[model samples]
Target: MPFTPFHMGAGLAAKAAIDRHFSVLTFGIAQIAMDIEPLIGMIRDADVLHGPTHTYIGALAIGFAVILVSPFICRPILRRYNYEARAMRASWLACPEHLSKGAVALGAFIGTLSHVLLDSLMHADVRPFWPVSNSNPLLGLVSVDAVYQLCFWLGAASAIAWLVGKYRHGRENG
Candidate 1:
């Protein structure tokens, strides 16, 4: 699923459930990070689409990298979005510039790990535990159609939940 929006569904659900403890921006960055290897392979017509980058070791490395750099990358974007949200009176969409390092790390890890997990189910070439063994035990754990449906429904449900929570909070404050 190169460049697929389906990878974002888990991140959306996590952000909705863990708001302050989940950085959607960091999660998104990790998702992109995970796919970079695959994208490179596709462009070069390499035999290995899912390489070492799809492994848990790779995820840890990518997650740590995101944690180190996400604040600098996300702060400005979040500030701009917050400014626009404020101008539009859409407080629910507003974001803060200061995100906890722990939260960013958590989100990044979740994003990378989930990407590996989901892709492992559909992609026979993904060896999530690469260094341990080349075999992908998780391949075909679920149908590709089921994976798509799950991702879509999870994203929809989480978005609705987040909106409702934001609306309720606004009402209470008002």
Candidate 2:
């Protein structure tokens, strides 16, 4: 549970404006995305890989993967802003602001990796140091029970709400 919201919220915060509703939503989704496999397998299989989302390599790969796809996601919204690219690369653009493709890729990588780190701390048996060597520390710090779940949900909700309110306020004022 901790990993689900934390990872996703980090994703949202990284991709969108820091205080945007969509960022929170995206974070929540990313955090919970891997849970479904385990939940379903718990009833059917005794031993499952818990899916790739739990792995550090998997998280980084997924994050950058999402960023690579972001151009498609931004295309429609960007159209109104008259967004243009200096090159044909989807990852690079020559827009109103001065930015680099590396920045976007880095943001996507960090956003996703944050989720893996947060989740590994809470969930036991997670192989964070995977591929590089599945060596990890037994940092048994937190539990993923009702209270913790509620807190994570609340944090996500609050961040999302704040972002929405800010967006609305900005629209009204602008």
Candidate 3:
């Protein structure tokens, strides 16, 4: 699932449910951060496609990195998007000008850990508990088709829910 939109589906669902507690931009950054090692491995044609970076230990490290950098990255992005939304008179869709440190950390941790968990189910090379054991107990936990369907359905359901919530809220406020 490296470089795939499947991961974003989970992120979207999370954002829909916890928009105030989680920064979607930070979550997205963590997702990209998690995949960078695998992308490099794919380009280098390394024997292990999903190497140490796909492990829980590696995810913790990556999550820390995301927390450190996400403020810098997410702030500018949110500022610009918020500016555009304000200009367009769509404030409800805008993000905060400054994200809290807690939100960044939470999003990063959730994003990276979820990425590892999901990949571990599909990719036999993903040893999520590595450094303790190379055995991938999560491999084949679910079929690839089921994984895709889960991601897609979760995303669809979340999107619908978010939209409905926003619509109802808007009607009440307006």
Candidate 4:
């Protein structure tokens, strides 16, 4: 994935489908963390754009790091979003000011792990197994266009599901 935003489609869908268990905020942070290596490489013109950070082991380490640091980041953002939601009269759009440790861990792992898997499909240098195996058996399995389309449709589905869920919840409350 060229951008973390593309990965966010999955996070949005997961958050929608499993509202209690998934934290899209934490997921987004993990996605950004996964991409940091590539971004830096691209900036510095490094020979290997996808280095060890694109590997499963590295991603897991990053996931744990993100999990540890997410609370400090998630808190203020959640508070601001919830505040804006209240002012806009869209309380349903508001989220808890604090994400449970479980949600943060779940989102971090899902985000980082899935990022590596997805990148493996498109980038030849993406060695998910890394130290265990340098060969990317998953590369070229799908076209880059297909991956983009998948993300786009997932985002569309997430939006539709959210709207429908909101409507249903409003009716139930009424």
lDDT, candidate 3, equals 0.86
Say which prediction, candidate 3 or candidate 4, comes out ahead on lDDT: 4
TM match of model 4 to true structure:
0.94
Q: Report the C-alpha lDDT of model 1 over 83-115, residue by residue, as the tens digit.
A: 998899887666668999778988899999999
Report how far residue 67 has shifted in candidate 2, in Å: 1.3
How do the residues 1-174 of candidate 3 rate in per-residue lDDT, one tens digit apiece?
Answer: 888878777877877887778777888899899989888998999888888889999999999999999999887798899799879987666666788888888889988999999999999789999899999898898999999899889888887877777657666776
Please give the lDDT score for candidate 4.
0.86
Q: For each candidate, what TM-score against the reference?
A: 0.96, 0.52, 0.92, 0.94
Off by over 4 Å in 3: 170-174
Q: After superposition, how far is residue 12 of candidate 4 from its true place, in Å?
A: 1.3
The per-prediction CA RMSD against the true structure, in angstroms, equals 1.1, 8.5, 1.6, 1.4
Best by lDDT: 1
lDDT computed for candidate 1: 0.88
lDDT of each: 0.88, 0.52, 0.86, 0.86
* Shift of residue 35 alpha carbon in model 4, Å: 1.1
* Cα misplacement distance, residue 172 of candidate 4 (Å): 2.4
Q: What tens digits encode model 4's per-residue C-alpha lDDT throughout 13-34?
A: 8877887587888999999898
**Rank ordering of all candidates by lDDT, starting from the highest:** 1, 4, 3, 2
